[model samples]
Target: MKGCAFNVIIQLRELFNVEGQTVKIDDTVSAEELSALGGYEQYASDMRLLGKIANRAGVVTLSYAVSVTLRHLCDRCSEEFEREYGYELTHTLVTSLEDDGGEYEEDYILCPENALDLTELALSDLRLSLPTKILCREDCKGLCPECGKNLNEGGCDCGK
Candidate 1:
């Protein structure tokens, strides 16, 4: 899809009277647009659109639960690592954050005042699900501290 460099940002509030029996949002959220976000990395080949837009209750809540296959570089081994990120993402449409926050600790939701940029929403939800530290494995020996060679494959002789 052609992503407009000017209005790559979207406002969800623009979605009004948007009720569908089953609406797939992947079309709405473009991949090229997501790549533009700073430090944005998306691995999932597809986005699973599983949620509802309840314009009836004067609010729209979206639920996300999709598994993504991402190719990551191991911090230690410097090898390509394939990982899957799967989880449920939820958001509620309200007028302001003050309405939700100040009350209780809610997970993550969106406000109605702004247009619900599906692209931003997806990027944010995916970003939060990412791990702080990436490792090839739990017992990974990692690269040699001195020679900087991958120790998992036993191809380096750093101590010699």
Candidate 2:
């Protein structure tokens, strides 16, 4: 398969040694790529991933933190705001070249090309890690329904 510039590809041959080793990954990937891999709302230009990947017993595990500054329109106010989010994610990877009609686990990843793509894994974790509702602030007054005014900024003519 063709690899993109931002796709995190790790060669399967790297896990040859029995002793586990740590691989550090730190990079910025575009929101479009992430959204495609996982059903995540892509409001940020790029997402940052920084953490470690370890391989043990032919299984690869990733433990990392993902950070993104998303440009979101407040759900209540409809006002634009930048929200920063940090998510810590961990996942176990499966490298399967062929399907032997065996039962597969939920987190089983089929890496037929011998190059594991971690971009999808990271995006999946991000999707699950994100909050259901994204708010600018806890005490946000939101917009006045009647006059469509930002109540957080100031009072509106539509008296409560």
Candidate 3:
């Protein structure tokens, strides 16, 4: 919210009226604010969001790609490392839900006021896309069970 680039609000009124209308947004989100959200890893760099909202044949949709670098401690070896991650996300936007029963709530984003908060939407999507398990590498040997030495470096004194 403190950053300038990611705090974008789009008026969906025009997009809904015209078919094949598209609006593109490119911005950077602050790493400090994102890291303060309380996650296992910290964001080392600002997140880059490149996205487009389009009305195709009366269907309005939002599609975006997010990229960022994270600093994490390996779950197995306890080594600190940084890794880059990218996610492609898409969602259908609707002014209102056809039914009040909320059956199709998850299938679409409702913008009843004809406005969309791109910052909040992108942040929510990014948080959901984070990985559960983190490792330095797929084949990490991990620490020695007995002496607590990193097995990836070499064998420990108490062989197992």
Please write out the lDDT profile of model 3 over residues 93-120, one tens digit for every residue: 8887873355585648889988987767
RMSD of 3: 3.1
Q: Enumerate residue pairs that collide in model 1.
A: 11-115, 11-116, 12-115, 12-116, 13-115, 13-116
Q: State residue 41's C-alpha deviation in candidate 2, in Å.
A: 4.1
Once fitted onto the true fold, the runs of candidate 2 whose alpha carbons sit more than 4 angstroms away are 1-3, 16-21, 30-46, 96-112
Q: Rank the candidates by TM-score, best first.
A: 3, 2, 1
Please count the clashing residue pairs in each candidate, in the order shown.
6, 0, 0
TM-score of each: 0.67, 0.71, 0.78
lDDT tens digits, residue span 50-88, model 2: 987788765677678888777777777777788777888
lDDT of 3 at 116: 87
The sequence of per-residue lDDT tens digits that candidate 1 reaches over residues 18-69 is 5432233433333344454445464535444445444444455666565556
**Model 1 local distance difference test score:** 0.58
**TM-score of model 2 vs. true structure:** 0.71
| Comparison by lDDT, 2 against 3, better one | 3
